[model samples]
Target chain A: MVIDQIHDLQQVYRKVVHSMSRPGSISNLNNITEKLEDDLPCNHAFFLCALTVLDAEVTFHVVASEEKKARLIEILSSYNMSRIAPVDEADFILLLQDAPEYQMNQALLECKTGNLHDPQQSATWIIESGLLSNISALSLSGPGINGTQQLQTGIQQDFWQRRNDKVKEYPLGIDLVFADFSSQIACIPRTTAVTITEVV
Target chain B: MIAKPHFAFFDEGSKKEIRRATLKAVAIPGYQVPFASREMPIARGWGTGGLQLTLSLIGRNDVLKVIDQGADESVNAVSIKKLVQHTTGVSVTEKTQEADIIQSRHRIPEKALKEDQILVLQVPNPEPLRKVDAREYMTKRMHAEDDYSGAWLLLFEQIMKFGRMSTGASHPVYVNGRYVMTPSPIPRFDNPKMHQSKGLILLGAGREKKIFAVPPYTSVESLAFDDYPFTVESFEGKACKLCGSTDVFLDEIIDPDTGERTHQCNDTSYCMEQLNSEEKVEVENSYV
Candidate 1:
């Protein structure tokens, strides 16, 4: 579907900003049709985020199987016009919840955790999920959080542990955007202290 | 939400670019994210950074307030207010409490900002290490390595030279215990206002092509040695002549006739509000 590039992107960018600044706050991405095109590998929320943030200036990496990666890249490129780069060099990484945990971890490990001076140089991971039930509950406390907030993230426990491990280095980890199928989104910046809650 | 021709004097493309960078800045709180800073009608050093942020975030419903050094009537402030108003047609206000977005040159408002408000600071040099090392590459490397000893050393040297730490403005601060950032050119007195502030503080350096943020409820500590603690610009016995407020940051004005220097609160609106109140409004001390 043809969307209003300027207005749609502006609305999407505001949602991304809102979600990123306030961790675990759900915001919906606008301008997406109810029907999903067969060619696209994921939901329109991911595409909306990719379109708003990815430009000719930045490169993106899609983490999936070989077949899925190529298709996702094609779809992202068609929508955003971002350069497709290697996993380590990419500014943005798109990972699906169904993607193999090992592959996801490998791609995330390869992704740049920018050095102390330019932490912003690191990659932003956009993990997409189909359902809220698939996500794990996490207790979050950090800068943007008021006191302590409990959030259910569309990320695997193993991967979440690995990601949290990477941030123990502090100021040198990737920021995350958790995008759900219906376009509901939340963020977990690197500075946030996240703990996996035990399921009762 | 009206489809204005160009939202806030910038085309959608420019606003999108700024929005992208701003999101990154928020995600990586206190990390300076480089962006393609466009040339504004105003000069580079005089708050183009803050203007870019203000324009980008401004919506039809936003209430904007612009301040230079502290006064809303300053040339820089008035010019910015006019430019934003001319473009977005957003409502403008002089009161700090009423503004949704505040674009400031140097000083933060005297009253505490609310959670919904945003404070945009026009940063001259976003790099706190600039005073220590002139080379940008080395400074970047230093920041990458978390080697902020140079910043501390610079402070030490200042104490050595002045017999005490005498950084007047643009003092270095540590945000989220990560990056050492210049809290714009606000006087030392205003530095404490940033610590776990309710409002988000965005710092933009147009010439430097960098933007950083201190998100709401974040810890922002001004760098200081334990013995020689971080201190604000002192005005212990001084009170504003107009408002009679002693806690607020004061500006000393000299009379040409008698050559007598008298103090007045730097924040004009807050001072006026205080003066107009039937009962005295006390600003709680936030000093370290």
Candidate 2:
């Protein structure tokens, strides 16, 4: 049984990871064991795909309440993992929903945005919500931006106040990966500049 | 479910980022370079960080050595050794003299490393300024200009309360006389080994998504005030029970059946070698 479960984990993980890396890439994860019932579907997928890649030696921050932490601990413990590290300490930050701007930015600033030579040292956020796509929200143009993609959402009020300030410190901000249970992924790297505008 | 771990446990892109960060770290000597750290087959607090660094730097010819608390038999050490051996099929040794690349969790070998050796430490926390500055952006700017006043202020605060700095482990050191780098969880006893070492020193935080380097033949000094200059810890006359050697780190092992506790050498391979060589000498003397 252990072997079978491990085998299933390996197969589904590859697809889930591919979906997370490449934007618009979709992959459905099938291993929804008894362990995943309590969390949001997106967070369940995050644990299946994310924790399969990170654990004991790789620190992560889960931005959920004590109830959620206990549930996560129970689920993660089944995999021989102990303790959920704090947000600042975690290498991966998992949020079961799109956070208010302050919380998101706070999490972002707490992440390690890599040093000079290798700018890829940024945090990976598994937001259990949507990375809204709209032209008036924020402007993004980079390797994954499709020559300039727009994120349309009511980006939190505080996030906009510091948007330009944060963007000016390019390649030193958080990189986000929003995953829906259906298995969709979107990312914004430090190199990509973002500008806020209202929807018409 | 995830696919089986890639060749060295990291995908090509992840390896590429670590490789690039490592190269830059090498270029700047003591500078910390950030990489898009990928989750390895290991857990976060264990040695995921060091494993990633080893994966990035390892090639076909490297001889790997992994140790936790200085012992080859430690559970975490055993786990890492298995991963490296399985992933790379490279030769692994517990002997400090034989290993070309040593990935360690919390201790350095008692034997002095040669110029060609590489010691990669697994750091739980990479930033020394993190406690003072909660904001990464602000700390980056401070490090950019070599501003560490906040760190001193904290240390001063420590002295005020305790009359001395009580920090014992994960002590900070300036690598290559430039960037201030953390030597992970190693005790002050091993911190001296970081200074002008014969081998390259690398630090990685797998969960923190950062990697840093300290080149060979460079300065790495623990931060200290003149009034309370740094001091190294010694075990005094305590010797490793397994090896009967006095120079290595010791571990307090409690017998499972009996609640009795005893001291043993943390470096199991070294201890065993010492025992073997001592027996050999006794045999030779008897023959003579």
Candidate 3:
């Protein structure tokens, strides 16, 4: 069934806004994800998020296996009409569950972190990961967070470290959104200061 | 007689562009993210920025409140409310507590906002450096280098001229301890309310085509010297004439007939809420 673009996207966008504003907060996208037909190239929640923000005005890049990347790009472009740019120039970069650690790190390093004058020009990384949990090794404290918030994600520790290195300078960094198989999503914006509390 | 407009008035593409800008604005607290600001049916300078944000974010179930300088019934507020209601058919309210999204100009609601609610402020000027330096390119470079000496110099000049910082509204603030931002033209009294606010606050400048945000729980500090501190408008020994409340922000009024000066609550809805509750308590006491 085709989702109502106006209503459904509005709901999804609100959740995205909530997650972005309050880092480490998890937003459940099952209401919209459950309505999607099975067998999409990307996660349902990720697809909904892409649809909510992507259009002809922007560009995106997908980081996945050769075949999956092509299919995901084709589907995203056809649906949203956003151009498929290179990794460094893409406004939105998608990291599928199948992406290797090395590629994820490379994408993290190569993605645009926007200059100080116009930091908002940076890319947003939308990753399809394993299950998302509230309690994890990562502790976040920053603009959106009231105090310190504990969050756990299936993403590798190296990626988080690299993200920290990329965003060491204020106002110049990429934002992250992680969507798991359970239709749960969370975001860590550039303003958030993330620290790995546990090795595991 | 007029055909119904698209959902939220702007086309889906325009909404998507604005949403993208808004997301980026939220991600980088207080950073002015530029976007293609569309023309609305209303005039540009008159709350179009906040109206665009309200129209883009309003959902079918959301309760919207529009206030111009704290008056719910002001011409700008009422006109914008009617436009949104006519376009989306959503519910509108005067009570700040009942609003899911509050689009405001010049003032924040007197009551504390909840975490779920969002405040969209219309900004006449988004650039805090515009007054210090007129060149956009030079100001961009200054911001890129973390050089806000010009802003400080402007404040220092104010002190030299008036013996006190004479900024009445649109006071500059340091957000997340990085970028200096103008919290819309909100009075200095409302500037403190933006610090670590429970609700998300988004400021949009439609004419300027800029958007910025202060996410919930963020640190928003007004710029001030250690000795010359930032102070809000004092209302000591003053109370709202209508509600008899002393804590809230009050507007000075002059009696037209007697030429006597009085102070009253600027937030009409908040003052009305106080009055209604007092009446209820009085009724219950009489019965007892």
Per-prediction fnat values? 0.63, 0.00, 0.94
Worst 10 residues of 3 chain A by lDDT: A128-137
Choose 1 or 2, whichever is better by TM-score.
Answer: 1
Better of 1 and 2 by DockQ: 1
The C-alpha stretches of model 2 lying farther than 4 A from their native spots are A1-200, B1-6, B252-262
lDDT of 2 at A155: 35
> Which stretch of 10 consecutive residues in model 2 chain B shows the poorest summed lDDT?
B22-31
* Ranking of candidates on TM-score, top first: 3, 1, 2
lDDT on C-alpha atoms for all candidate structures: 0.82, 0.64, 0.91
Compute DockQ for each candidate against the true complex: 0.54, 0.02, 0.89
Per-prediction RMSD in angstroms?
5.2, 16.1, 1.1
Q: What is the lDDT for B200 in model 3?
A: 99
Q: Which candidate number has the best DockQ?
A: 3
Q: Which parts of model 1 have CA positions greater than 4 angstroms off?
A: A1-3, A28-41, A64-72, A130-136, B1-5, B279-288
Error of 3 at B128 (Å): 1.3
- Clash count per candidate: 2, 24, 0
> In candidate 3, which residue pairs get closer than 3 Å at backbone N, Cα or C atoms, i.e. clash?
none
Model 2, C-alpha of B153: deviation from truth (Å): 2.7
DockQ for candidate 2? 0.02
For candidate 2, write residues B80-161 as lDDT tens digits: 9898878767788878899988998888887887855778898888888899889888877777777878877877888999
